[model samples]
Target: MTVPPADNPARFLGRADAYAAARPGYPAALGAWLEEAGLLSGGVADIGAGTGLFTALLLRAGARVAAVEPNPEMRAHLEASLDGAVRAGQLSVHAGTSEATGLPGGSAGLITAAQAAHWFDPARTVPEFRRVLRPGGRVLLVWNDWRAAQTPFNRAYGEVVRAHTGDDPLRVRVLEDELPQHLPGGFERHTFTHDHPLTREGLRALATSVSYLPNQGDPAYPAMARGLDAAFDAHERGGQVALAYQTQAFLGCLD
Candidate 1:
């Protein structure tokens, strides 16, 4: 599918590619968990699909997918990755945000937000999700959070990000409050943790992908980079760093 240039005034446009490369994808365990819970059937909506990371997994699991993403660059990456599958109509893309998905009401059997729910306005997004989903449809909001404080090297890296970006971890802060009230009755929560090894380059890319990071030419950018390098040097073993994540998944069924 041909995509237009990113026109959204959001800061994510510039870092979309970095995000695609650096960010971890949802765990295979999540797919199993969803299947065991009987939530992986009919059609699924990948809210904030972002480069098709989680979207690819949904496709691999034999789920029909509707990708809703507002950023054109990310959408383009998704289209490029899916290529012929998209042409054959196995996947579809919509230029929309979480709060306004632009899909038909009662069309989706499952909805998922992977690592991008924090950017959503829950007040609007929750209702919109309810509209798109069929009765008994499930919503899964998930994030892969680096366990920065558990290790010295990770903590040091976290400090650098805090000092430079002034933003907390990428996990959505509203899930705790919104999930209880925003979701209709019959809600449940699940969590699955996993680890992935990262090289110095991967760590740097992960840090720089944040929306708040300064670009290459900016003076603060170097400071941010240097800080990240120091953290990696401190804990890197065998030319790689062990990055651990507390991957969390929250699931709820819309009444």
Candidate 2:
């Protein structure tokens, strides 16, 4: 697929290769919990299913999925990589965003947005979720929060990101009342903690995968790469550095 227009939501363009190769996968426990809770019984609408990471997990847990994404590059990677599931009728990819998913009304009993809610407008996305979900259907908002952890490598990585963008790399940076205000039914949060170990090449890919930081082609990328290298050298053990991540999941019924 061709890239999205510059005026559109094309932030993930030009980095899909790095994004798919290095972004952290979700915790397996989350999938198990969702399956055990019966949330994965009916089909799932994996909103903002970038590169089909979380969508792949949902499929493994025996749920059919409609993986919806907006960026053409990201969606194309998802479609190409998960073509087996697509061919088997276990998966379908659609061109859409969180606020305006092109899924049918009441098409899914569970709606999920992993590592993506921060990109959505809750005022619009919340109601759009309700529109696609059946009565009593649930919504799950997920974020793999590396910022929640405090470790030497994590701090160093954050410093590089902050130096480049003047913003926290892994934080959603949403206002306090951004989505909470719209969740009249309230929400429950589940946390799963883990470490992701990366090689030198993997570390570089991880840095490039971040949308806020200077990418490989950017003029400032050399400086960013140096900072990341120093960080890695200071913390690497057996040729890898482990980054801590806390997968935060907020669940609620939107009916």
Candidate 3:
């Protein structure tokens, strides 16, 4: 997968709704892992916190969360989604990127980028993350990757995406290969299986939510939608299909 240009907010423009609605939240086991590892002992910073998906998880785990996101549309959705938490003083939304989080130095015990690390320029963001984290603080990178080989529908869907997008650097699996160079101190890896049940419409939204995929106006979009429909029809039972995912977490600290 080829990496897209950094700071390309246009990729996500106008797609915040689909992204918020279709994206799978992290598994509860992630919170349990954080607790066990002592990463949540203080405030947390969730960088690239699109639509508050992972931010909600951090808040639910009783941590004061600062959700740093650069895209206005995505950030609006995040703020709206976590309005209750904001009013209660549990979560704060910031207009910032991974490289420039606007967080005070050494203020966070843990910094996380859930499904967003690929957008960052590690040269800058890694050092910035280290700056914001207190001593012994951890950085957790997470993704809910499609288990493409798990079922016929999953395999077909994978083919469709690759056919249209060519090489999608945003694919979660690529992170595992690239992260080590950025965090050379090494990371502790963990994986858990999760499934999201989706209706045909929900499946379509999920397909389009990916940033690298062709959008509605693209010449290939109709075929993309058709592929997703076919996958849904083949796998769906009782009006829903189970989309399998391998939720991966990589935990480490800067030297």
Candidate 4:
């Protein structure tokens, strides 16, 4: 399958299923912290809320949420999965991006971008966030940093992914830069350990959900599968392998 160009906003169009199935959610502890910090009050705009992974968490915490996503396919999944919340007036889904949220000025007290800040152009995103946010509103940037720790399984899994990684320009898996610099003043950083328990098939789906990595139909998928299978075999216990991640978060207000 031909990969979509890196600039294509709908690049994730077809991978929504795998992504929704395999991607991990933010830690419950993190949500509790946000509540304790009073960040989740007044309502939230979950920008780049792909498939509503983080959006669901916000809803659970009793925050009135507006989920904004650009890709129809991914947004469809989110809407479908959270239709109950929509009907109950707990959630609203919008088709938008960080640079252009399509939300009213001062509509939200908080804005969040989970596993999506790397794709945002902070110049526009920061201003857009500021517009939608109420006075002194905060923005939360979250990512499951898979490379934050060096572990046996992580090293082997990294090798498997790197082996077949082509010149896929859309492969912006990690945020090389921090978002706090753009969100001057009011900033605090925190991290929590998290893990996803995956069976062999779940492991494959997790890797396939990565657009840069080889998918099920890609030519390199066979080798990728074998490599990942081996990694799982080496690390699996009780019929599952625990994939480790550091749930890193940056909470700050735009100046």
- Each candidate structure's TM-score, on Cα atoms with residue i matched to residue i, is 0.88, 0.93, 0.93, 0.91
Q: Assess each prediction's global lDDT (C-alpha) against the native.
A: 0.76, 0.83, 0.81, 0.82
Give model 1 RMSD, 1 decimal: 4.4
Off by over 4 Å in 1: 1-9, 166-172
* TM-score-best of 1 and 3: 3
Query: What is the number of backbone collisions in each predicted candidate, taken in the order shown?
Result: 0, 0, 0, 0
Deviation from native of the Cα of residue 2 in model 4, angstroms: 20
Let me know the TM-score candidate 1 reaches against the reference structure: 0.88
Candidate 2 TM-score over all chains jointly: 0.93
Q: Write the per-residue lDDT of candidate 1 for residues 138-210, one digit (tens) a residue.
A: 8887777775326666577678867875644433344465666445655667777767677888887777676
Looking at model 4, which ten-residue stretch has the lowest summed lDDT?
167-176
Can you rank all candidates by TM-score, best first?
A: 3, 2, 4, 1
Cα shift from native, residue 225, model 2 (Å):
0.2
lDDT of 3 by residue, 126-221 (tens): 889889999888888888888533776678678777778665645554456777755667888898888888888888788778877877787888
Q: What's model 2's lDDT at 240?
A: 97
Better of 2 and 3 by TM-score: 3
lDDT comparing candidate 3 with the true structure: 0.81
Pairs that collide, model 2: none
